[model samples]
Target chain A: MSILIDEKTRLLVQGITGGEGSFHTQRCIEYGTKVVAGMTPGKGGAQVFGVPVFNTVESAVRETGANASIIFVPPSGAADSIMEAADAGIPLVVCITEGIPVMDMISVHSFLKGKPVRLIGPNCPGLISPGKCKVGIMAGEIHKQGNVGVVSRSGTLTYETVAQLTGLGIGQSTCVGIGGDPLLGTNFVDVLKLFQEDEETKAIVLIGEIGGTMEQDAAQFIKDKVNKLVISFIAGASAPPGRRMGHAGAIISGNTGKAQDKIEALSAAGAIIAPNPAEIGKTVKKSLKY
Target chain B: MKIHEYQAKALLSQYGIPVPSGDVAGTPAEAKKIAAGLQGKVAVKAQVYAGGRGKAGGIKLAANADEAEKSASGIIGARLVTHQTSARGAPVSHVLVEKVVEVRRELYLSIVIDNARKMPVMIASEAGGMDIEEVTLTSPEKILKAYIDPSAGWQDFEGRKLAYGMNLSAQQVKPAVKLMANLYKLFHEKDCSLAEINPLVITGDDSIMALDAKLNFDDSALFRHEDIRRLHDPAQDDPFEARANEMGIKNYIKLSGNIGCMVNGAGLAMAVLDLINYCGGNAANFLDIGTVNNTSAVISAFKVFTADPDVKAILVNIFGGMARADTIARGIIEAYQQIDIKVPVVVRLAGTNVAEGKRLLAESGINYIEAADFLDAARKAVDASKGGRN
Candidate 1:
């Protein structure tokens, strides 16, 4: 009943021979993700955690029928890996790599236009279907299968929210990190649309930070189309203007991209503001009760 | 990643863009010589990696070589404070002396990676020499924009169409087309995230020239361009940010606050800062440890925090799902032992081997506050900072 990924979703590991790729792939498999294939040039015929390896994404998809890919390639080659996955016609691509050159994403983003595939992140944590399947580097032990759908821009804060939810016996249906890059594959509005269509997702928890108009756009979409009870938390309340708050996209320029502006917009749009990351689960529960 | 105006103009000129004939000089004598070579009225521009230099007395007009030398003397070795740069001002290491041109009309033109559109976009405005964001917010219709095709490139026809749409003269359109082509080439070749010409001025003879330039390179692509590596202006950047980059820790920018943040990922570190602010606290700086496997990075992070006198408290938030918590815990312990920290530290450790990590922290006998969860940690950090302030 989870959205985007679940028990049936077949995953492919890009850069599977690398230290991060191999380590996370094993963890993902241990958490019950159906990792069917691994892709690393010149390492074709090798097996990582018993997963079949292929030289190219096309060959891997042809042999294993892997419809989704989790890429751990370095920033320099990340855009190429994303384009290759899109070309292979994979329905979903999650790029875990960070610090990708903006110019590289400019080309990759233009190429993905009019394509049916969805790109998740360049500097983001991958998605998880709670206890069913974990396709990212998020702590799987903190997640559980439940009715709440979680979507966020921050990684550790997502884990913190998930841990709090699990502590209160409120599990998530699906959690997606749209990433903190200025030009991300998915946006809050896109993931919200998916969560809105999923029947298992009763209430949603959205974790946002300072910078960009994505939060405002999400609030607008939530007001018009969202039927589920949604509680949100916008971070970087006291962030200084023109300063990038860790993430490339998290910069407060001029009057826009301020946390207060985003909080006000979301609050006016009928979203219960958590005010802090620690209150996300409790805030969602209160919204449900109301 | 932001380069000085002279560097940006040099890059633009290399791509065959029509930039004013100019040369950078490190001293007043060199400035006089460069101005003499131009053989006309010249503009002396102080070289600093920030915008709004024109308003800061950084830009001066010289009627002759002697005047140019005086202007360079006034600017060289002096800090220029612009609206963009802080009150402390940016020290001018060099001056760009260029031949002045007779201006007919000024128009704004730039190509930037539009995140919303997810493509390279061309922004053209009839109103030039002003901030583009203000133009976008006040009179968006005045800004004509077109998304470039990544594979097909920015064709001359597209540039000509934009010129005609913006009501440029027939002669000016030719140079505009050439400028657009060169701009796109420079953008791709230099791996620039942003390349802007604030006042693309049309001369009396109908020739177009870039009067001002600003360029931001992609930090991830620095390994490829050795020329850009040489242009790294550490004077224009925050010392903490530069030091963090050298240590492989993701740290940038410093803020005027009392609480310092140390977290595993960028997004999470931002969230922690936001949470601190939400709880009535201010973050001294934004720091992301970013997948640390070694203790040295942790020590570097500690050194960065301790170096800031305003940092009265520190918050450490890590979700070691990919990295083991015990490893991070050991790193933090090593960092604590290495540095003489005056601020109280609050630790919130989660994920794999978290219990062992917490146990190690407990055994270290360091006077640190431990929180069972993120909320408690934030509350403790904020309260401790407030207490210290009192």
Candidate 2:
């Protein structure tokens, strides 16, 4: 079950004693990632590594039930700690804090309307499912469980496309960065409709870059609902066109945010097109010919 | 971030909108003493930061004050080319002399922030003084929109429902909904990622005004607008992206290509400018240096592409998640022992301390080149920018 999180994802950190939240909450508690609780508004009974902190994400989700939070809260208190983790219900918030302010993400998108919250990234670099779970500042020994889900927008180009799909053995069923901000809280068709309802994701990839239309709306939701093997890649395909550095609604919505207009809209909505950024994991190991 | 249309009509005549009586001038005798105290036809214009600028003559029209001092000496110190600039044009200096208004129609107004409706929209049009992407590609109901709801705010009926969906004139819809609610309070007290006016005319004494203004702001909220960063001009950028954004390396940028790469992560500096232009070379700039473990902002972005003479071949590309790799190999050997570079760099270093950042560049005696990843550092920085030595 590697989608938004895994291994019974408890998490919750929200600026837990600062400095990139106890240094990526001690590498998300050494990558096993249950992390539990931390908050730190007034340094509530502090403790960081052994977890338990709480100054309120409503007292660390009523004493550590936590249900997934993250947020290293800076950039002016990251939209009020993402509406205090969606009014302390935190059904996965994420936000690794990078530079908030797009009018505080349009007031955290009108306070996450119709909120049964999902949020994910104020600036980003936050999810992971490999080896069950991990959150935020990536590089947990370049991830590995297996299934190839990995979405992106670029936190170190999703750790160089998840360390070239865990060095070709191809392992991930969940990576998601969704950050390259121009206002975001999860996109690329909201994590490609959760990697098309992930059945331990058979194959996905997607990396995308250079100003939005979220990869032509994730190539029309992977050609009207993905059936599996995807690939994709874009990453500013040598961004050079009369580079007016972006948007007048891309000259009024013809959206030439280029990269061969998102590689001809994800190869005419069927996907599979890594064509360099060193062939994203050899175009998903030659399209799942694994 | 794109001001000048006389700093967007001096911040839209300080929020009460109605812009027109101008005054920005660097010669042509102060644009003929501001077009000899306005009144009739004037508008000299040309300020830069792209946009058609009256079909690149960078706007003109005068008639008095010695034809606005011969239209500010044919747009002060020439260089405008515009199909939104960069066929190496944009330099002009300053002009803006204003006072033309006599239109009677034109409408368009803007605002921005829609990022797939995360909201702040506005857009509006009446097929305005041409181009709102050709009125949404030929009258898509003459482009009018509204958005705003920042948790129930700015709802003066979303600027009177885009001034009654842009057909105004019920006494111009309450001063065009009080000039779009004081341009949404000067686009929310000047964080302004594009406020624009385009035409927003009406005039010939019917009042509406702002015949073209522009705005933009929000370079990450320009540190709470020091009065919109004193109308920042930095000679309209690209002096190596305003000296790599004055060395804090706000993602450096430049680009004409000679391979400069310098990564740290703006999505791995755009996948090292797309695998160094998909391995044929041509990257010349795009610095990134973020994910701050600062190595002196990577030795001031390696002295900004080793002081760019169209950089010959740099690369560097560090991954180092919390950035270590021997502190970016002692700031690229202290910027190759305090600059005097000549290009050919290449490096590569991966996440965290990659084998003590490749054994401190194989016990330094630096002639760099290392590679082994990112497609062998983009095919050895596109074969060291095609045999460097420039």
Candidate 3:
């Protein structure tokens, strides 16, 4: 079985009346996700694509038994939405909003400490369990039900890796975009632990970019505890130092978060390294063969 | 988003943080006047966005006012090519002339968002002036990190622990604690992503001074700080990048290649660039249209990409998961009609009424290549480039 989400997971949509929120909520419903309720602060009595809308997350959770919340709020309201979901006792919160202030995330992250709820992203594409449940803004048509588990910091890079895997006739158990912010709710090691425990996930593919020591920490985790066949690809191989490549988290500062250093660390930890994004799935397939 | 040392120090001084007396000089004459007023030795630092200026001969120690003037003349208009700066070199806009203090001890201090810990972290090290990475790789124990809770104020005990771990003297511990507290204040108040004081030196008479400071403001929070917005130096940035920022388009970095990529989302833009490189084609630039569904942003992106002489082929990849795929397609077609683009255009559209998007592209009759998957799109885009048939 996949981790975090499956067919049994009932979901709620926060900010569901917004254009993006309504559109993606409809897509998720069409993709067979159990979207029990939608929450828009003032539009409580309304319905979006036949899904019941409520004013507050607590009401939606209480009435529909929606255990998870997917937030489509804008950057300014993202932190409050996350906290509202957390306070409502939703088991998981997936925030698809990008460009939330770092200070806002600082408070959100600290508030999440020792809490039972798992927070996914403030600037990331949400996670998906292929063919079962979909959350966030990733294209549902590109994913397939398979055994390979994918985790990445980059949303489009995750899409590329998944598309390649689907092309190779390999499906993913779950694909998680942990977001590209400097302060992510979850780390590579946290996701690796879930992937390692999933029996359906025979092999895992990690797509990382330059910046941060998350890869190094993940490499160390794999070196000690992980037993699954893992293949990884770290982007920004030739990226210049100190320049932030697209994502706020993808900055190369000092010597801590270079691609070469990440590649070396992952390689030394017995993980196959795909130097290019195009070869990520192929490298994972090759690793599984051996 | 990287502010120069003079700007950072000026901000720090405004927040009551102790920094050496300094003035920014755009001309050699101004530098000489400032150097004359300062006692003893003065440090002339190049006011560019890049780091490692000292190694590039952009930073020089002047013994006298005449020497400072000479150093300023040498660095003011000269380009400094450091490992951090581009090969084209970063043009020196101004020079910061500051009083040189006699250092009794040097320490490294910074407050940055720690991803793994998911908090604002403070890093302190006894070894300063040199790179902190060298110290981390060789002897990680030299670096002491304190993860601060945003809800609670900067814990004095945490600062004391870090101060003791860094082997600070009794006289230095109080100021170090105060510095860490003030640094956290600056980090939160300024909405900074990173606030670093490399070589936070202790003077001979036991006063702590921020010798060099570097601050990177969070671009997302720029709307809140108008003062920080005024310090932006467009000359230190690429013209196209500055224009992209002004238009509210996010991703724009100048690369030395031939294929120009205009895509939606940061990750997709990077993946497209990576795919271009993998296919033996170089990407000239990275341009993300962000989340805008407007036609003007699309037209602006196309205009910027086509303006580059090195761009031989343009790749437009939009997944349109939340955004309407057909809207992007319409924008692309509208841009092609409005702008004069000489390069071959490769379009890839997916998600949320992709058929409609493809239909819009078909109606354009622009002789564009369409692909179903990312690989096909990347391959087709690369193939359209000169000598990329293989």
Residues A169-232, candidate 2: write the lDDT tens digits.
Answer: 8888788887777677778888888888978888888887766577888888889988887887
lDDT of 1: 0.86
Cα lDDT, all candidates:
0.86, 0.79, 0.86
Note the B-chain TM-score for every model.
Answer: 0.95, 0.40, 0.94
Q: What TM-score goes with each of the models?
A: 0.96, 0.38, 0.90
lDDT, model 1, position B82:
92
Higher lDDT: candidate 1 or 3? 1
Docking class of 2: acceptable
Is 1 or 3 the stronger prediction by DockQ? 1
In the order shown, the candidates' DockQ scores are: 0.70, 0.28, 0.54
Query: Candidate 2, chain A: TM-score?
Result: 0.38
Give every collision pair in model 1: A236-B274
How many pairs of residues collide in each model?
1, 3, 1
* lDDT score for residue A144 of model 3: 94
Candidate that scores best on DockQ: 1
